[model samples]
Target: MIRRSILFCLMIVFAVSLCACHKENPDPSGQNPDSSPTPTTPDTVTIAPVISGGGINLVAKLIYTVDASTAKVVRSTVMVRDDTDITPALVIDCIVESLKDESLNLSFDGIEYSDGVCVVDFDDSIFTIAGKSADLEDAILDCIAQSVLDNVDGCMKIIYRIHNEAYSTVNRHFAYDFVYMDD
Candidate 1:
């Protein structure tokens, strides 16, 4: 008798669940109210990235190194959005893309961020920017350093490396090893 009572209760619960599963939608349109798709908008200034990781897709003020002959400042503020994960390396890549007529052709091999300091390892391609005047190289580095510092939160310093090895100078001009956000 107890077994029959348990089986009967189980049968009732099964029927209730089946009924719940087939219930009609309250909306006359037959669409689930919560299943509407959210709209997405692209970043305001869509510049094609030379080295694409993906888009940051947010409008932001970025510092770009420009030809000093044409610009009032060597490094000027510009509004732009480009592809990347907002990491130090990607932000530097975006800065490279923004450079006027100077093709540095550099990329980061690895990047590590911790406690507001970002250590960036680069391939030997970093030397490609050499032979440019020391001041121009400094401007380029400043552009990269300042852009990452302004965009990525909590990143207060950037240390340079060649294939994970420490470097004291880059492009034979600017002092490397570290760039302070405060500077």
Candidate 2:
């Protein structure tokens, strides 16, 4: 009788232990037994402007993206002029025409204004083709510089690059720097 009583106590203990374990580990399917949802922390987010602004009048801070295959202006910023007299659209059109006239063999992709710099990218062909004459090369660079200078207010200098690589300021055919100013 004593042995049977001891066995009965052991069975009760085992059953109780199993019940506790089951409660502790209710579901492996990722559901909580308490039915309360876990709290989530809010995430911090950062925002950037679609179009950047604030610079000399006429010179809109711009980033230009040039088409790689067609060598055309894919996009540009609205012209920021020194004088509010000129509209941004007209200035952009003039710049585009000037670029096309120069025959740089590339097109504008787009322009983004950020900080104080105007980053302009052109097609790879701008650097690929060799000019036959020094005048032609200089004219191309001059055209580029003038186009930006005429429409943009604060751009005294242009940092030109093709496919993100800096091309020589030298006229390859003439073996001399392309002079923008007489002095």
Candidate 3:
């Protein structure tokens, strides 16, 4: 008689469960009404770089040497602190700044890289202008050539000009066409 009572209760519970499961469970497509919308990403982001390493090695040529009989363009290494920037302009500017001083008679108007060559605009008319001696011009050109070859990268050769125009006879012998041969 006790077994019969237990079996009757189990059958009643099963019937109640079947009725509890509704046929339309919120249409299966739309949200549950309590949920929120999905998020989207932003359009653009601008951030500065946190650079590492000590930075690049540069060579600053000695522009002023009284003993111009020998090579005056003595190059030495300089370590640039590139904490946040490494653009070509920045690097070139740094090189020019490193080259600056009263004794060093060299100055750069500007420097830019395009296509394949790096154009270096020099501000030193002291050598390229009216009636400077050819030897002086040659020495200056040599210094400029060596400096560019030692410091800059990516370009096969460097092109130097004063005020954007090529130097007359100097470009023939001691040209800015210093080609980089890989070691």
Candidate number achieving the greatest TM-score relative to the actual structure: 1
Pairs clashing within candidate 1:
54-83, 54-84
Q: Order of all candidates by lDDT, from best down to worst?
A: 1, 3, 2
For candidate 2, the 10 contiguous residues with the lowest summed lDDT are 174-183
Q: Which pairs, if any, clash in model 3? A: none
Specify the highest-lDDT model's number.
1
Candidate 3 residue 66 Cα shift, in angstroms, is: 10
RMSD of 1: 17.9
Candidate 1 residues 1-183, lDDT tens each?
Answer: 999999999999999999989967699998877897876743465555568875444465556564644322255444544443467766666666765255446566887888888876767655655444556655655666677787787788877666776653544422455463443
Misplaced by over 4 Å in model 3 are: 1-71, 82-102, 128-133, 169-183
Q: Which model is ahead, 2 or 3, in terms of TM-score? A: 3
- Candidate 2 per-residue lDDT, tens place, 105-169, comes to 44544433334334454554444333444554444545455555555555444545555545443
* Runs off by more than 4 Å, candidate 2: 1-93, 98-105, 108-113, 128-130, 168-183
Q: Assess each prediction's global lDDT (C-alpha) against the native.
A: 0.62, 0.47, 0.50
